[model samples]
Target: MKTANKPRTSGSGTKRNGAAANGKKMPDVNGPAGDGKRPSLYANVIKQFDKAADMMRLDGNIRKILASTMNEIIVNFPVKMDDGRIEIFRGYRVQHNDVLGPFKGGLRYHPAVNIDEVRALATWMTWKSAIAEIPYGGAKGGIQIDPSRQKYSINELERITRRFTFALGNNIGPEYDIPAPDVNTNPQIMAWIMDTYLQMMPPHERQRCIHVVTGKPIKSGGSLGRDKATGQGVVYLIERWAEEQGFDLDGSTYIVQGFGNVGSWAARLMKPHGAKMVAVEDVAGALYNPEGIDPDDLIAYAKEHSDIFGYPDAKPIDHMAFMGTKADIFIPAALESQITALTAPMLKVRLVAEGANGPTDPDGDRILLERGIHLIPDILCNSGGVIVSYFEWLQNKRSEFWDLDEVDAKLKKKIVSAYERVQGVAHHYKTDWRNAAYIVALTRLENVYKERGIFP
Candidate 1:
């Protein structure tokens, strides 16, 4: 598949200075802010990219092209609420790169959604696709609305999603750009977007456009294992890490931050391997049980109560206590910048497998590195969703369906292969796994640019 080559204005000059192109003085990566003010997400992502690019001596032209997004689209559309009120919603879609193939990412609905966050997510998607060896680039988008709030009913959400899709129009397409479920989004939301996009096309074109958005309900063309793909991928990489270290997963204890789809699924899957969940945290509150909490029970409670705060099997604990809970592994499936200078020193785990994008800031990374903590970077660790989304896309495009066993088998193969590649690069460079993952991704992107060259 091919997309129209869109020229983006270069954000970087020929000079390879450490400072950002926007004139903000670059902070010392080793030492983050002491005042606890986290840097911009986009700046942090750029710092990671620059480190890999410099380490590998990436081509200057490719560096310049990737320094900024190829397209930053913001749409403000009005939606009529169920209460007979018209509310204007702001949405964003940032296409970071498309050198590999079509743009692919997720659409999230949260009040905190902003341009910088969207850009950072889009940039991460680029690395994730490259790391997974998928034929896709990166793009992320979201609307500034709190889906969890009770003010917006289901009907309101559908209208808002449909109107946002209408506003995006051709910016998203089956072969050009595809959106999937992200934070505060589910298969139902994706189905709305897919239906909205299809309605915009004629009957003949509608059939071909079902692949425009993935993570839909299975009846609506979603893959069998799409819901748990990210969590399963995280567990797969963790299993590989255990094998390399000669550590047994059976009887190991783990703690998870964020009891969302990724966290819950990971906990449940790891249970079959004899791993135990000692603590779980979410937006509502945190829960701890030294004797091990049952993931199945906790998930059911969370579904009914909206979070894992009041699970009867576990006691309520504060965030600091949750972090300090001693466990064999820590899975941060929450928002970005959660583990910074303040929180990094509190983690009691030996390994951190990032289930969410950009969970660790640079300072946190340095602290973990200094403390001899092992990490499975988010780009490589949480890539199962996108990898399977690619499968769902293929299925839709070919009018074929895959069973759960087939999807799970294919996902494991791709994720394990990517994990091995990252491990190999880490060994070759003698760098931390995070940096090695970035290098692996950048190497692929750099080589593609070298072979393809810039268009005339």
Candidate 2:
């Protein structure tokens, strides 16, 4: 548990902390550029939207509408700390667009989390839901405090979460902005949100409002396979891509950046296909093993040491070396803007399946395109988490639970169909996959407005 009030980020904006084997500084992949100005994630998202809109020659009015956020909710509430100190915490909920359906996204807990990042994520959620053919728009919110470095205990965190939920009040609901787990947040935190929201409602409403938030524990109305859905989705896409490109996963090597829930599950799920994860990198440091490290071993090490920076079983390597490793695939399951213009050229992978939202910046995407790297857009690649989240919401609303296999099977079908649709759209437009994905989403929204027309 983290101490409360004093906030810090989880290795975000981290500089070149590791030196290369030749003793030169490793370029900071996810931090401020040479001018010390951090790249704007929201701006990057807009750039993608603009490019797609241009390709489609979309109407100016619709383009402007899709390019902007629909609603922005910011709140500041005081939480009584364990030491009886009242510490004010800032929170934000950005509902990008709900034209398709109710707003849906995640609630992240990180000190580095801000309105812009949340807005970008919310916007991406809109595209993701559309690409996956899910009836959801987009919204993302989070409290601005690092879960790891915070001074709050479990009880204090619960109080703060409930108070935050209380502050949002009617802004969230079963058919409205549904929040799920994001970085530094998990099922337990979601359970707290669910319980708090339920307590505030009337008896009949309380029983029906559990869908106010998805990603809760199973007992709390969460779906069976929601935990591994995102990672499983990544592997499913990789399998289909491998088949399309005639690339064999057997005896093939890949590199995973970030060994959290997404990266770890990706490795474990891919091992059965004989795919080898040769390198792993996280905030602690990077690890390399050409012989292939066991996914279970790595998971156990991370559990025991709280990280995988210096696991004795693998050779520790630098950031540049990890990026430059010989691999068939590179999964950036870490943070936004991790692969910048500088580090983009160092990639040796044939495919980049974005496991994290906005992992590749606009500049990086341009470089990858010029280099002919098969870049799977984050919106489509990471739609599984939200898709499974939709399943959880559906289960709660219908008062029916799905089995693990049923959830996984449904997620795979939805994501694979999305991948095929994106490929066909890209081919038809003569554009890249990222732009194609945006077009798919924008076109859907455009049709909605065209038929319904803007209200007074």
Mark the 10 consecutive residues where model 2 has the least summed lDDT.
17-26
Q: For candidate 2, lDDT tens digit of each residue in 1-456?
A: 111212223443534222222222222333431234776778877887887888988888888788888877777666776766666666878888888999999898776677667778888889889889899999899987755534568888888899999988888888988999987788999999999899999988899999999999898788998888889999999999999999999999889998988999998888999988899999998999999988888999899999997788789999999988889999999888988898999999999999987899878998999999998888899788889999999999999988888898899899999999999999999989999998888888898988888887
List per-prediction Cα lDDT, in the order shown.
0.87, 0.85
TM-score of 1: 0.86
Candidate 1, residues 1-456, lDDT tens digits: the string is 112222223343445332233222322332322225767778877887898999888888899888888888877667776756567677888899999999999999876777777888899899999999999999999987777556678998899999999999999999999999888898899999999999999999999999999898999998998889999999998998999899999999999998888999999999999999999999998889999999998888888988877688889999999989999999999888888999999999999999987899889999999999999999999999899999999999999999999999999999999999999999999989998999989999999988998888
Best by TM-score: 2
Off by over 4 Å in 1: 1-40, 78-88, 146-153
Q: What local lDDT score does residue 24 receive in model 2, on the 0 to 100 scale?
A: 21
Clashes of 1: 0
